[model samples]
Target: MKGFTLIELLVVVLIIGILSSVALPQYQKAVKKTRLMRLAPLIKAMADAEEAYYLANGQYTPFSSELDISWPDGTLAGAATDDGYLRFSDGTVVDLLSGSSYLTGSASAYVMGKTKEGIYYIHYLDHSSSPGVRSCKGDESLCKSFGGEAFNGGWKIP
Candidate 1:
């Protein structure tokens, strides 16, 4: 008599469950977006460094140290593997694509970052062509949710 009946308790539990189910996905999305946003600044810095290096040397270098930029903490500057990918301590993998003759430019470079959730972000810079091209490759809905435009079978980020 003092407490709620079984039916009333069950209803309360059901409502709580429903609310949680609705909120969980949104929380996860926010987490994912935050993770992606964290890498944006790093990508921009890398692009700037690559551009400066290209102007000085007339070519891009795959080595982060050669660019003369101050890398962020937890960045493994010496941890570049044979495939030219750098792994961060926070499970982010970055690959600097440089010195490729495929694009028409004095030098073309792209800094790609792959988050722990398997979302790939690419910041492409071409000195003679497009100065900045930001794109994301992953779940279409997720990409679009974070303000990505559909471009050439990929999501172009603003």
Candidate 2:
């Protein structure tokens, strides 16, 4: 009689539980989106560096060392390779898509990363066609959140 009834306390608890249930997933989604957003600028920087390198050398190189990129310490891991591919500490991979076709006129590169949930996000830069084209390849909803348009079984991020 001095305090709230059992039914009243039960209702309050249920309401709080419902609110938390709804909020938790949204919070998780926001965190994931933030992480993905951080990658975009980094990928774009690499693409710009690749373009500059190509202009000077007339061909793209896969190694980041050859490009005018000062990668942050701990950003990259593992030993260097001659194959023109680099791996980031976060498990993302950047590959310079170069070959005879590249020297013939088409020069391009791509950065690909996979989320813990097995979703793949890819950013592609094609100097021959569009110069800087970003693309995504998983979870249509997630891709659309990045302002992507569906194309060829994937989303082209704008």
Candidate 3:
């Protein structure tokens, strides 16, 4: 009588498994959310720095040193490559492009943004045109598309 029966043990195991199945997904979602959130400050900093650089030089500087950012690992300073993607150590990516989009003209317009887990934040600016944030709640694919008249098609940062 002191020991549990097989049926009781099985029932307990089943309950535990069911709870874990439900909880694990939520835990993963929270972790992904946190990872995305951590990029927000960096994105904002880059945008601010870009704007300042534009004000000072009349155009945004692609060099990370000029932007005055203490870049983390995997930070791509400028359009070193054709993709214009800045890969982070955490697997998130940022695309800081000037003008219309990556591989486009040179201008004061700038976009510093990041995407992770289908969430994205884009700080867009063009001194003579549009300037604002383009945020995609879900679906990274949607984020890739130009948001609207107020938003320009940013570079595909992966």
Candidate 4:
């Protein structure tokens, strides 16, 4: 006799469901931000390895062979194609930057591209390629943030 009516119970359940739907996307975005941040350190590590290889060889070595040294400790949760020159994870392939010293100087070399399930980025290898000044031409805001003779930010790559 004290129990709530079926209509009241259903109304409560519907409210809860509505609340969850609104909150879910925010939670998902937070998760993505955290994941993206974790990748920051990994990116730095890769960059360090590339620099080490540069110091030892005078320039970037072959992208394939040099990748071993480029990411000397790379064991991230991704599939490394010939070391870490190319990293494929969660359906995304992140290619390290290189030049003729790497993959015949193809666009495949000289830049790193990150394509997430919903986002993408094209990273350049030098300041010369910064936005209006480089080969990247999709997102202007992202391009401007990317810089350095040795790096570019993780862009939304195609």
Candidate 5:
């Protein structure tokens, strides 16, 4: 059996390390973006489900029943539930009553932002806060007029 020289092994290890170092952050960011992106579809799906529930009952709200949810795909864990309240691993909240964490519950309606803290927004993040690209709401600077312009009383999603 042939054995590799220490120098050769060191060079190979160094090369692998360099490649990993350069690619790791990019990989991490991509994963983060992908995870954050799931919020959109999740929001849409939840909104649709909630709308259906509302149409059937004439009031909009995610019933306090077991909801089979797949949390952050890229970063968050899988097979989550809203049986009690929407909660992220980092303690971010997303329930209709507990709109204190990431945008999950009613936020499936409006306002969205992704940070290391996770996707966050408020109940009725904004009225003018369009669902287009780069529409900022829930941030104090934008909702400075008091009563939070995005805080539309009751649900907004249909």
Candidate 6:
């Protein structure tokens, strides 16, 4: 006599479920966006290191002492493996998009994973390409399709 009817209980449960379902995806998206934004500073730092190395060595080296990245040191399965993001020798980190490590390409290009998926690329744009600017590239197909915001003489989210 003091308990709610089955219909009322079911309605309450359904409402809760619906609310949670709607909010969960939105929360996940926000988290992913935060993760993507968090990498911006790291990418910028890598670019700065590359710039400093270029000035000191007269050319960019894959490896730069400017980065104090923590590289793993140890051997696994009788093989020595180092999990270092900075290449300090060639300025490149292999398979950066894979998220196993931060990556750099060519002389002034760096790419890192964004959020739960995709990748963010920061590199120098040649004057012929975008009037010479350091630009960050997001999902390329999205950029081409949606026309991302322009900044620093190039697309900020391209």
**Mind giving the per-residue lDDT tens digits that candidate 1 earns over 1-158?**
49899999999999999999999998998888777778899888877887777777776775665765666665764554646567888788877764352233644457778888988877777663445888777667667876856864668888
88-147 in candidate 6: lDDT tens per residue? 121323222222112222333443323335534444412123322434345444333325
Taken over the whole model, the C-alpha lDDT of each candidate is 0.73, 0.64, 0.59, 0.47, 0.42, 0.43
Q: Using lDDT, give the best candidate's number.
A: 1
lDDT of 4 by residue, 30-143 (tens): 665444444444444554565456556655545544544433355335445554345544544455644342432234334443535434333333222342122333334433
TM-score, prediction 6:
0.56
Q: Is candidate 4 or candidate 5 better by TM-score?
A: 4
Clashes of 1: 0
- The candidates, ranked best first by lDDT, are 1, 2, 3, 4, 6, 5
Q: List candidate 2 segments past 4 Å from native.
A: 77-109, 128-130
Model 2, span 68-115: residue lDDT tens: 766667877764445666667776665554332234355434545555
Q: Give each model's clash number.
A: 0, 1, 0, 7, 3, 11
User: Which sections of candidate 6 miss by over 4 Å?
Assistant: 64-108, 114-116, 121-155
lDDT of 5 by residue, 1-158 (tens): 59999999999999999999999976875665454444556454544454455455554443434233345554433234443345455444444323321223333343233434343433232212333222213333323322323334311222
Candidate 5: C-alpha RMSD to true structure equals 10.0
Measured on C-alpha atoms, candidate 3 has an lDDT of 0.59
Worst 10 residues of 4 by lDDT: 126-135
What is the TM-score of candidate 1?
0.84
Please list the residue runs of candidate 1 whose C-alpha ends up more than 4 Å from where it truly belongs after superposition.
75-83, 98-108
Which pairs clash in the backbone of model 4?
98-110, 120-155, 120-156, 120-157, 121-155, 121-156, 121-157
Ranking by TM-score: 1, 2, 3, 4, 6, 5
What TM-score against the true fold does each predicted structure earn? 0.84, 0.74, 0.65, 0.57, 0.44, 0.56
Question: Number of the top candidate by TM-score?
Answer: 1
User: What range of 10 consecutive residues in model 3 has the weakest lDDT sum?
Assistant: 149-158
